[model samples]
Target: MGAPQHEDVDTVDVDLYDPGDGSIPVFRWRQAGQALATRRQLREMGLRPGGQSPVARIECRGGRRFAWLYRIDLAKPKLPMTLAKELALDKAMAARQTCPKCGRRYHHVLPLKTLGSCLECHDGTPADPASYVTSAPAHRLAA
Candidate 1:
């Protein structure tokens, strides 16, 4: 129902866990040269964490996971997309639209598991059609 209140969780650990709303919610920003940013924050500035571990974290509401904080000073600029990488991404997206059983490409991704193929190839019979079509019992006349 709530974040676990352990003695160790009281102090925020930049390298381990974030102090949630349960007690301390935010960390102090110190010095003019220091900078901290989340993943999306780095992306907005056209930079990435570049395989560096987070220097800090901010706790989320549900306590599922902490939002990692990266030092903006150490972040690297995002790489430009290459022609080969562009082509590979296009091919992978196309594969998702193609149905393996029917060997056909669909504008929408096919429901492969349930229908096992395209809707046209699927047999549409009900699992128990007879049960659905039973007639009502005839009423008997009383004396």
Candidate 2:
């Protein structure tokens, strides 16, 4: 008998960083395989995890940074934006872009949290006329 010969085992030159404690497998950087995708990647593909748990993880920089990997086939299509959602989002943005003192809604976000009002109202800086709407409709979203 020569040195004990192991037979009937499949071997491949791939690094599977499994913790061996029954946890999900880990892969390095771009080694997570084509079937798996991170959350952001799924979103970019117009998909969502759809309540499915991650089956693996991909790490980089010596495991200091990692992202969960989900099966792309198990992902669901991203939800479509509805009229209600658009209205609610617009309302929220109005609160941030509208000046509290003059009620003018600027196209850009205002520093309300810091200065408590627009620059013109806070420090007498003359804002550009093209920067804001003089009078927004009272019920823009009304039918």
Candidate 3:
């Protein structure tokens, strides 16, 4: 027998989306003057820098355009958005809360309303407890 002939194979266009008259492409790219930084975010996320990267097709309500981030795999485990969100919330609640100044992380044992700042920031100075708990600006923190 010749190499067992399998007649049928699937080939199709997988470009799941249209970038909306190139506006989305321009919006997606963030570069400085003379800086090769269009969509530079892909680099840290272990993706190619050039515009050849493939974005995933995720189901969403309201049809609002948004980006979904994930590591590439031949197949990824699927879950409904509600369950996925619950799992993420549980995991985040379980994380060790960190101190910005001292870089110490401790179990988030206190009640959410009661716990204001990390132990170090709480004891060290009268800075806004909210400040230590803040996230970085969108432009500064990529991927």
- The candidate scoring highest on TM-score is 2
Best by lDDT: 2
Q: Where does model 2 exceed 4 Å of error?
A: 1-18, 82-84, 87-143
lDDT per residue for candidate 3 within 1-143, as digits (tens), equals 67865521121322335543332322222221222222333444434433334333232232333343222432223335688899897657644454333443344443234545554455654545454434442333232
Going through the candidates in the order shown, the clash numbers are 0, 0, 0
- TM-score sort, best first: 2, 1, 3
Spell out the clash pairs found in candidate 3. Answer: none
lDDT of 1 by residue, 10-112 (tens): 4334332344444434433332124878898899998999999877655543333456678898999888658678988767754664545445455565567
TM-scores for all predictions: 0.35, 0.47, 0.21
Per-residue CA lDDT of model 2 for 27-75, tens digit only, reads 8878877899999999999999999999987777666567889999999
List where candidate 1 sits over 4 angstroms from the true fold. 1-34, 60-65, 82-143
Error of 2 at 124 (Å): 44
What TM-score, to 2 decimals, does candidate 2 have? 0.47
Model 1, residue 35: C-alpha shift (Å)? 0.7
For model 2 the local lDDT of residue 47 reads: 98
